[model samples]
Target: MTANASVFVEKLRSVVGDKGLVTDARARHPYLTDWRENYLGTALAVVRPATTEEVAAVVKVCAAEKVAIVPQGGNTGFMGGATPDESGREIVLSLARMSRILEVDTIGYSMTVEAGVVLKTIQEEAAAHDRLFPLSLAAEGSCTIGGNLSTNAGGVQVLHYGNARQLVLGLEVVTPAGDIWNGLRALKKDNTGYDLRDLYLGAEGTLGIITKAVLKLWPKAKDVATSWIAVPTPDAAVELLSGAHAASEDNVTSCELMSRQGIDLVLKHLPGAADPLTDRHDWYVLLEWSSTRARREAGNEGGLTEKMEGYLGEAMEKGLVLDAAIAQNEAQARAFWALRENHSEAQKREGPSLKHDISVAVSRIPSFMREGLAAMKKVLPEGRPVPFGHVGDGNLHFNCQAPAGWDKARFMKHGDAISRAVYDLVVSYGGSISAEHGIGRLKVDELAHYRSKIELDVMRTLKRALDPQNIMNPGKIVRV
Candidate 1:
């Protein structure tokens, strides 16, 4: 430990008090490691500040001591964004104790929530008031609202409602220098310059810490329809998505593509998961459409299930879909969603894998899958490339599960080489490398390689301008 280490700890404890300060190594284990267990880091201590002002004070002390503050929420980020470094030079500022639902204005169609509020809790609170909070993710049960906003997380609902950044109206951030930037408002239309809210949305805490946010909400989707369709290939899945979109126009909410391999993995690895169709197909899509109860009462055309049935029939005739099963009630609807949401967990049980969250143009999704999967197999002969995700939004998980009975370490050795090959192809098709997960420590190099020089320069400039000291979440996002 440094000569001044004890003094630093004493100051931090003074800021957050003894109850909020955690210094034991065992107690800090959960905060030091990421959700995927890919990155195991060490921290001087894990400090929990219960309010935004307390967070600011803690950050201010750390900045003065020239110590790094790793802003963590839920520790549920997959890319190691919330995890600290192995050097043990940083302090983990956990927002877990800042769990407060500040306000829920149904009339304004928005809610102001503290950063540590569990995502599922916010959803339930919204539901209680007859409103919907649509920033849903697989980790909704454990991930905090702050972490979701930091990563700008995308889930199955992203095809219908946008990602976390789009759902947020404003943010309250603690700058690196310890000043709190308060921009919390429920304004739908703000013609402000630069849209500063976006800067913090996906910054991964490089510029500042997100303490609270004003998130947009929607009227509860009462009349809803869900379907699981079997398709011949990714090409066929694309056709089905287009057909459904054409049928529902604006009402089409969720469109997710699932590979047969992905579904099989889910059923085999995850309990209570089942195939909705009797016969297996190469690919499948779970789609949903929704409308408010008031809208449903106005006309028969508003019935999403009937409209989807007609669309499916047309798609079958056109050879776009082989067969499909539309959920008849809420119970079946939940079951269908379970199959899609259980993908990551199921894949984990299969083996350690190289996961990519990349996106291309919607029209190019099929081609990207065809070419990308082929390229990956060529590099590693025994690789099982499972490409599936939000086909409607053109984002594919494009993960490669290790071949059966292969050495886990040896297979993982080629992770970078394989990532390079896949990312190169994505760029050729004008796609993004880090689609939903931010460019945390994991993808920093990938971002440098795939991002244009001009874009990198702009990002660096922004980071430098906002965080001149570079004390906020060091070694994340931009290299600065």
Candidate 2:
């Protein structure tokens, strides 16, 4: 290490101890890249602080040296938000060692936790307290709460509970200037001054580092019903969901849409993942309804399954559903959900792919897919389109896997053109090019191009005002 880097390392070690720092190249490799393997960066050192006070101390050292700090949590982000740059001058501030569950207020329906705590752990803890923390995604086993708040992640349950931002009540953040902002209040309504908690929630750690959070919770579901249905088209799936709200009495927890192509990939790659139905169809929907009340009887009177069956029968009569299967038990329900959750892993194993997390108005998803797929095929005729996601909330992972037997270098040649076409179509439909994933150097150019000038100006102004030195995750959402 250079003399300056040696000095910085010593100061960081003094604050977090020798065991908390990782300087060896091999030990630091995983933290240098994102989950998608799209970015392999370099860092001077990876600092693992075990406490909020230690985190502030490390930030103080970086702020004094004018060195950039890349705040990372679990490094599970798809947009490369937590990865450092190739310049080997930046220090990676990893929060893996700081995981702790501080409090669980069952009566108040809130959970207070450190930033490094895994999401699944939080869910389990809430369940132990007879409560529920509903923010869930595929990577919940490994993804951290800090990163979830940083990206404002959206999962299947967004159809009912909303996004990560809505699930959080307050946050505790460490500013770029090495100061702590303690706003971790479990208040249901805080009408004080500005909502500083929001400013740090979706900033992707560019504005500040999230150290802790006060998350909202709800009562656990006592009775649940899940279904796997074959829909003839995207429009049919939408119509089915529209009719389900009234039928399910607003208990629809999740409603995911998938193409037959995506389901085939899941069956091919994911072990133990079986197709729920025997007959293959062009489109399918994974519908789930959860209720806080227990079942009144074994059959029809007030059972969740009976209500779901009734809805499916009505939908079939209207041609909205071609075929359907309601899960007989929890195991069957999980088996059905495995098909939807394993989509990304299966796609990765298949080949190089272009994944776009775009969104449009709920009614315009069908038209968007029609034009977007055509535009993509016009560019790469042999591309394999795997379009699926939380269609109930209007977000679709409109991804395209590389053609069969095509290498990464070869398939990526058509990536730019395909992405441009899809993004253009999304813009025309008055939709977002990015729904949950932030810019995070992946879509920086697209964000600049698609977002209005005034909007970009306001974001840049906030970034500059809060993180004036540009030491907090530089070259992320903005180019300030």
TM-score of each: 0.97, 0.98
The CA lDDT of each predicted structure is 0.87, 0.91
Residue 359 lDDT in candidate 2: 94
Model 1's alpha-carbon lDDT is 0.87
Which regions of candidate 2 fall more than 4 Å away from where they truly are? Answer: 297-302
Candidate 1 runs further than 4 Å off: 1-3, 294-298
* lDDT per residue (tens digit) for residues 1-480 in model 2: 789788889989999998899977788899999888999899888999998899999999999988999999988888888999999988899988879999999889999999999999999999999899999898899999998999999988998999999999989999999899999899989999999998888899999999999999999998899999999999998888888898988899999999999999999999888878889999999999998888974443667898989889988998999899999989999899889999999988988999999999889999898998899999999999999998899999999999999999999999899999999999999999888877797998889998999999999999889888899999998888
RMSD to native, candidate 2: 1.2
Cα lDDT of model 1 by residue, 1-480, tens digit? 675888788888888898899877678799988877889998877899988999999988988877898999888777889889998889999999999999999999999999999999999999999999998778899999998999899887887899988999989999998999999977888997878899888888888999999999999987788999988888888777776777886787888998888888888987777788899788898889887754457667548788888889988999888999999999999999888888888878888888899999988998888899889988997888888888878888999998887667888888888998999999999999988978788998888877789999999998889888777888888787
Q: Candidate 2 — which pairs collide?
A: none
